[model samples]
Target: MTTGLLNKSTSLDMKHLTVFIYLLLSFSTPLALASEKKNILVFFIDDLRPELGCYGQDYINSPNIDALASDGVLFNRAYCQQAICAPSRASMMAGQHPDTLGIYDLTSPLRRTIPDSMTMPRYFFENGYETLSFGKVYHHHTDDREYWTDLPDVPGELYANPRSLESIALLKTQAKTRGVKGVALGRAARGPAFEAADVEDDAYRDCAVANQAINALQRSKDKLFFMCVGFAKPHLPFSAPQRYWDLYRREQFIVPERKLPQGAPLLAFTSWGELRLYQGIPQEGPLSDEQTQELMHGYAACVSFADAQVGKVMAELDRLGLRDNTIVVLWGDHGYKLGEYGLWCKHTNLELDTRVPLILSAPGFAKGERTEALVEMVDVFPTLVKLTGGDIPESCEGTSLEPVLKDPGEATRPYALSQYPRGTKMGYSLRTDGWRYTEWVNIENKKIIARELYDHRDSQESSRNLVELPEYADLVSTLSKQLDTHQRTAARKVKAGQ
Candidate 1:
């Protein structure tokens, strides 16, 4: 045997071989450890308002999220920065505002501005995350599925119809019901049938969504996984299984403490999306008390159903022993309008449409606290990167929430900005610590339509319009200039950082 190969049957020390193997593993283990980076689970839901237990709107039941908030920091004034799904989510993922990217409507794809740029998932993927999502993460129909590493289900199909093809009769029945009169129900079924008979939760989308989510958790790839579970509910059609509806007794549910008369905001016309019509169940002016209660009941039920699925995913994270090391973020894309501001749907500049529920829970996250400082959805991208020890993109406009997430009150953002394209009009809203300012610019007229200012310390619901008050005219002008300057420069400045 050659000198180097002369160890055949030689008396090598067992302890020495063991130590050598251990030494070899020490180097290899970190490479294996690369596979063990922190997992990121973003629990996203659709068209949900921040009026739940965590936001201190005790009108709804949200025990799971409430518990999560109790253990994590909750942002009292978290804004989505955009109202509609496509623009808002695009703004969030790219950490830029819609106007910055020029993704104003559903027709424009985000790739135009951020061509070859890293989005939220892509950024995580660049940082070694095995990114994926179930249900709706981006826009409902236009999201890019290629971003996910492994897509177990088509987002469009997860709830395009709740159940798989099993019973043709029941499926058709639900479809016809939703189709004929179900704008509030969300999308109608896309499947033909299902073999299984309808069970209480079987027909509900979140129930099936939860099942698939749990399975995904159990079979996650070794690399750090980012599972974005998008829950589409309480957005419309206002349908859930009867059980969730039963939870809210008709008698127990309460309507708005007070209703605004049609003429209260003398000049504010509700933009015709005006709450005066279709606030909830009724097709007419703000839902009658009974109908309002019914709509809220459906909404709460859908939220609860989604929450159960969230809990299942959380439990599985723990089951897989990924709890403390993993970062979990649950947020609604944008807030919903439940008969507030004479509006029902979320295409407005009011707080009802701009505010969303944001909860972050993980091992090192500050717990059970609130932040009055401004935070926007765009901040989500930077925060995730910071938390995972990844690079924050120079293009990201948001300030890293690391400072605030670590210390609730110590967080400092002078303002949070939200914007949207209204019907042939554009609106920008700015929310600071003590004042909320909004200005609407008609696209056709190219001039400011309506300007508003609310002193948050005195009026939280914004029931009174401070724009016309002579004493507050200076506040209105100051806020108006700030909003204009921000719109003209924020996006460009963010891009400049890159």
Candidate 2:
């Protein structure tokens, strides 16, 4: 189960900053080679929305994940700066945004930009962690090889719809298969299970990763460990075993309430159509609403599959008596819009595309606590530094949310931001408790485009576009300016001590 480990080229847009920023961050060793309290287990899932039993979504049966939430702080308002896989993972690992890291697309590896900056697990290793990663934690799979002692399985490399590729090749040969109109989910794959009874989450390559992670946790001891168990489920092939699929009766799952409003003023940069396609869903071709409910049912099953694998590792931590000392963090890279705004996956400024479920459970947070204050995935890096009792590098872009961990409702900032590059400029989304404000800026090109305003109270499902609403004009303008200050300061934060 060797993962796809390779070096990726840098994104053309932010290469200059990445080069300078990379040269700046140095992984300084922890002051004293002595005491540390918690082991960190990050259960990183892919393309999973917070539709688990804990988040109040009734369709999915995810008891293990829900139990973990009950035992920890469930962050209802968490997010990745971008929604794509490699880019999102890189941003979280590096504590940098796509714009700054210059790894916005899957084609580029984060290493090409800032090859020297320490990663999340590497920080612990510098301070005394025996770091091990299984599955996809960072984009450059090769980077994992540098930090991890073992990688049992690689992520999905099956192209041409390995989902349908086998049959498609067959179909291509059969003349009757000509002009195939519909896409098939295709045949099931094969993989090992946690237990003979453990349901397989489709024969996803990630399942093997989960099994390997369990094996590692069971065997690990002594030194403080940073273990990342990444489950590549719910992300694609959208494939999972049929048994769990039978559990979610799709008609019971409701499409979030949404309606295109009249006179909706189009903001200059609001992703009217681009984001849907980014998710592998197309811009046009409205789905003939149906037993697609069943399709969602399958998604629910994938969630359950991921949850079960998470359970496997948690069971191991407890088996090793590491639960009392481990800081367990569960997070999805970014939000996925099932059908909201007609978008299938991610890449949009809306809450559905950017928001993620972040839960931190440890000795200190043993009693359930949560933070309404929005936080970015980048913050997880600095937060780990604080947890490991290590010096935070001067160039880190995020603030430590340790304060919020003490009290889930505590504040780190007035708002949380998610920003990324599009063509020559950057698009920014600022999330406050009550509203979401966004703008697109390109200083070199002298362009500040598109504004987005979503009043969560009135429009939680994000059914209406209020960026152009006369009433919210002042609010949008104010937030747009604030975005400029936020981005500049953050970029400078990463650039500091260079």
Backbone N/Cα/C clashes per model: 19, 3
Superposed by TM-score, candidate 1 places the C-alpha of residue 91 at a distance from the truth, in angstroms, of 1.2
Lowest-sum lDDT 10-residue window in model 1? 189-198
lDDT of 2 by residue, 1-498 (tens): 123222223344367777766565432223233434577889889888877788887667888888788788888888788877888888888787776777777788767877786777667766656788888776556764666655544656332234344544554445334543433212212111111123345355666777777777777766678888788777654556666666766678666433443333343224434323222333466444662354466567778877877887778778877887788889998877665654466766667777888888867653566557678898888887887667787656778888887887687877778765666766678888888877777748657665667778644565566888788878877887787787777667657624
Q: How accurate is candidate 1 locally (lDDT)?
A: 0.70
* Winner by lDDT: 1
Candidate 1 C-alpha error for residue 362, in Å = 2.8
lDDT of each: 0.70, 0.69
**TM match of model 2 to true structure:** 0.81
After superposition, candidate 1 runs with Cα above 4 Å error = 1-36, 140-142, 154-198, 257-284, 444-446, 458-460, 491-498
Give the TM-score of each candidate: 0.80, 0.81
Predict model 2's lDDT versus the native.
Answer: 0.69
